[model samples]
Target chain A: MDRLLNIDRRIIFIFVLLGVAIPLLIDIHLPIKPTPTVRAVYDEIERVSIEDPDRPVLVSFSYGASTMPEMEPMTRSILHHLFSRGRKVVGICLWPEAVGLAQPIMDELAAEFGMKYGTDYAFLGYKPGAQAVVLNLGQSMAGTFPFDTAGTPVGDLPILAKVQNLKDFSFVFDFAAGDSMEFWWIPYGQEKHRFPFAGGCTAVMAPDLYPFLQSRQLVGLLGGLAGAAEYEALIGVSGSATSGMEPQSVTHVIIILFILLGNTVYFTTRRRGGKA
Target chain B: MTRDSYVFVGFLALFALVNTILVANGALSLDWDGLGVIVAAGCTLALYSFLYKDNPLFKFAEHVYVGVAAAYVFGITWYNSLYGEIIVSYFDIGEKGANGGGHNPWVLLFPTLLGLLMLTRFSRKFSWLSRISFAFVVGVGAGLTIPRYLSSFLLGQLEPSLAPLTLSWAGLNLFLVLVGVITVLIYFFFSVEHTGVVGHASRLGIWFLMVSFGASFGYTIMARLSLLIGRISFLMDDWLHLM
Candidate 1:
């Protein structure tokens, strides 16, 4: 009981390592059910595809590389959905590191879908002043980002020809790893313009967003990796997030078992009036 | 400098040599992308080396990561914000009249002066000059944010919670949400003593808060596990090509 109570931290680390690494090596196809929150994002995108096909959609990368593990899967799944639906996407980076990290994923998906840069998509890249940029975009996207990442004027881009301001977009989605969704997109952009807005955030930031969702400020939200996996399942094209869920589930079970074991050991030791 | 330092240097040299030989033998492609994967895998392993014990490799990777991040931010700020937005647009440096000539250069002067004034914080005597810029920023930020917060966050939330309750599944869910909101607010309302009905309500509020925190904590664990799965997947698929 004492040995179980005071297990070496490194031994627990090894168990966790095996828990995560082993399932990844083996092929374990876990079922991913789309939650209503995630389904709302998908349904909104579909509605935009049917209702406002010509207008471009704004996808903001409000995350950096550290969050690439969680954020990238959401970005990839959303981009895949947008491109597969023949929706024109306008990519912008609210975070500096997103210019390097997130833009490649967009470009890769664009290539996969055989979409052209100037017409099917345009990446505006990063500019400082996140909330100010959101407000500026509400006014004039062309003025805030006069030129796309490739130095082509927004005027030259066919996809962005009608997209002079935030209201021009059919739908807006922000994959945020920070408070960008809550602080910038919600009040500065979404509320001011009254656009159909959704967000994807890291799991740590997920609970805080439920209030906004409840208020209908957010049309939908993809919260963390499970959310990404659910979106992938909905699209019928499983990607990294889907593949990642198996290991994630396996490790979670291990953690739960450890918690149970720890509690049992603690109670057993304390029943005899011993220090835990 | 020390035995462990020599051992570390030796390991790095061996790693480099192996990679070079792999490239020479066409096992690793002679391209930037391929080399980048190797470097990324190296960095990932170096950082993960900390799990065993604190080591020089982890510290080396940590320093390199910080340095690279700082440099990247500096480069992006200069190129994206300073050069593109300010220098090119305000001064019309690039394709003369590229910005469509509608923006007035003089319009930027006041903000530019305030931005420059913020630099005076480095000086001891003139540090007070920065206060004017700070005050303007805070005043404008508060003025812009206050009304938006009230209307969108506070009122928007309140209106939904107050929706007329009825005998439907959605109404039941809304009722629970309304109750949760009230009790949670009551939990934070500290002026009233928790002696009577308020005590039970506050206790129920604690349960609601705990459930929310437990959900948040579960999500936090899932987020961390996802990161671990990501690195492991990268090693398995990208580095080893086993998947």
Candidate 2:
């Protein structure tokens, strides 16, 4: 019993690695149904595009590379939707690491849509303070982002020419891990900026944001890999999230089996002792 | 004072001084409107005060942050409501009213009342009065979330678990989902005694939970590592062109 209780953590680590890696290698693209949360995010993006194709949508890449696996699919799908509808986009990174991470994705997607970088979209790069940046955006975007990510003056960009504040954007989608939620939602979403908001957050952090979602502070939420898969399904793109579902499914099953086996061993040993 | 405390304070002072100088010299520029580098430097120093000890400096900075946040929020609310809702929606500014209304000024009453009710939290005698506001907020929140949660969490989770049992690879997925659900459930079966069949199941569930937790932890590590890798990549590829 003690042996079972104190099994080497390395053994468990190996089991997990195989469990996640094997399914990933298999590349199983499981069909996913869009949950209401995922659908809500999709519907919001669609609505914004349909309602005002000319107005730019602000997307805050508030997560760093660490949360990319969970957040990237939603970000890609949302951007795909926005660009498909011919809406301009302004991407900002609150996390220092996010500016670099966002550049490739934006460039790739913009290329797909044949969209000009400055005219159709722009990356505002990273800012130091989160809440302050959000508040400044609400007040004056030009003042907050004087230049684009590449250091081009904001005035030179046609897409940002008329965008004076948060009100200029049709809606805001915050693809974040957790740091900027209180900053973006409480101060900006709930208080200053009345723009409809949606969020993409890691699963661990999803439940905490439910209150904000419930209060209508957020229009939709994409929670973790499951949410990401659903978003991919909605966009008709089988991306990393869709592929990841197989591993997620396998690992979840493996954990359950181990639990059952451990319990079985415990009961059988106890029963033998009773018979003795 | 401890030697470590003094060292920390000295380092923080140096950092603050450098930050202030950089901002003043336009080395670190921002896109927004504010007291420029002075406020940034002060806030940075204030936040860093925690490293030395939880003292008056940290408290002052924390309070200032709250105050500035509140002020910014007030400015935004003024702009949104006064401009977006009032001018655009009620007064039909720029012919952009969604509902085409110029005289439905009564719509502002609900928000006004709710805002007023929230202020009651400041008073002891009428603290209970805040429940009215709370009730309204909670009621609406519940109405919005319950239905969405049902579809998003319950139905969405169950749908994937209902896959058909087969002998092929697809069957493996179904098997995994079934076992995962059952075992994960057992892990959470805390109220029941760990005896007989229940004990067996519970033991299995614990392993499942541990492994799942381990996998999650591993992935979290990967994510963090990715952040580090990304920063390095930037420093190389974008900054110095070494990559």
On DockQ, the candidate that comes out on top is 1
Residue-level lDDT tens digits of model 2 in A1-276: 646745776666567657765564465666788888779988888887778778898988887655666677777877887788778999987766676577789889989999998899998776555666786688878656655655455777889889999889998888888746744445544355578888887776665565456446678888777787788888888876676677677666676777787787677768778321
> In terms of docking quality, how is candidate 1 classified?
medium
**lDDT of the candidates, in the order given:** 0.87, 0.68
- Score candidate 2 by TM-score against the native: 0.54
**Model 1 / residue A144 / CA error / Å:** 1.6
lDDT of 2 at A11: 69
The window of 10 residues in a row where model 1 chain A has the poorest summed lDDT is A146-155
Q: After superposition, how far is residue A111 of candidate 1 from its true place, in Å?
A: 2.1
- lDDT for each residue of candidate 1 in B148-198, tens digit (9 for 90 to 100): 888878887899999999999999999999889899998899999986899
Clashing pairs in 1: none
Q: Please provide, for model 2 over B175-241, each residue's C-alpha lDDT reduced to its tens digit, 9 standing for 90 to 100.
A: 8757767876876878877788877877777786787677666555434423323333333333223
State in Å the error of residue A82, model 2.
Answer: 1.4
Worst 10 residues of 2 chain B by lDDT: B231-240
Question: After superposing candidate 2, which stretches have Cα over 4 Å from the reference?
Answer: A27-29, A263-276, B1-243
The 10-residue segment of model 2 chain A with minimum total lDDT is A182-191
